[model samples]
Target: MTRRWTHGRSMRHSGAACGATSAQARITDEAHLVTCPDCPDAAEAEAIPDDATTGDPHLIETLRDARDGHTRKIDGVVVDATTAHAILTVYDAATPKTKAKIAVLPLTVMTSLAWNILRADVKREGPR
Candidate 1:
């Protein structure tokens, strides 16, 4: 028999019970068993789509510029000017930690998206 589990439901494993909300649940072959993606027994790492980053020309150029540090101030916000696309807001000029923020934003956004084109790609194809 197949059992379906809903979000916010609890499942027991190894005499220990755990509950997972919708966002914390991961899809698995065993419908009766819901596991968190971070759990040790969860599914293997997902494969990244090869074209995830290079799918859009504009996104690619913006990413390259940010990577090469061709940054400047535009309207009080730090922006990458390599392609003149102004897609990424590296930091705000008013911030005291502008330099530190610039270094951190790219790393954080590298794991996430800083602009719409990249986000759209991820939404369409799923995360990398």
Candidate 2:
């Protein structure tokens, strides 16, 4: 008998319960994580067709749609990252953006700060 998830959009296709492949189960689990109350989310619904180089040709479009649909609506954490394209859009003023895309630009920055904070070990404390 096939075990199934009855709640969300997908109809389960697996037969065995305990022996379902770990990788498949994980994919299904991730699909559930991306589910939307209004519509299908990343893993639940269709996305860009796979490409040879990046595996999803329309990945950028998909990400843009998701970001536009976000719930909390924070101010300007990210905006479309093009200048030439911005000329045609309403966000032209928000464009020619910076490249501060990473969560933390450098992990060791704290170590540098810590060293700078020590006042060079009092200068006279070092042996000759």
- Best candidate (score: TM-score): 1
Per-prediction TM-score to the true structure, in the order listed: 0.22, 0.19
Cα error, residue 105 of model 1, in Å, equals 22
Residue-wise C-alpha lDDT for candidate 1, range 10-89, written one tens digit per residue: 23232222344343353344644554434432222122112213223344344556447754322222344432332344
Q: What global local distance difference test value does model 2 have?
A: 0.30
Question: Clashing residue pairs, candidate 1?
Answer: none
- C-alpha positional error of residue 96 in candidate 2 after TM-score superposition, expressed in Å: 14
Q: Any residue pairs clashing in model 2, and if so which?
A: none
Error of 2 at 33 (Å): 20
- Model 2 residue runs over 4 Å out of place are 1-3, 6-54, 70-128
Off-target runs (Cα >4 Å) in candidate 1 are 1-67, 80-114
Query: How does each model score on lDDT?
Result: 0.37, 0.30
Candidate 2 local lDDT, 1-128, one digit each (tens): 43222223223334322333344442333335423342233222222222211223343343344345532111211223331122112222223352221112221331243344344555647767
Q: What is the lDDT of residue 17 in candidate 1?
A: 24
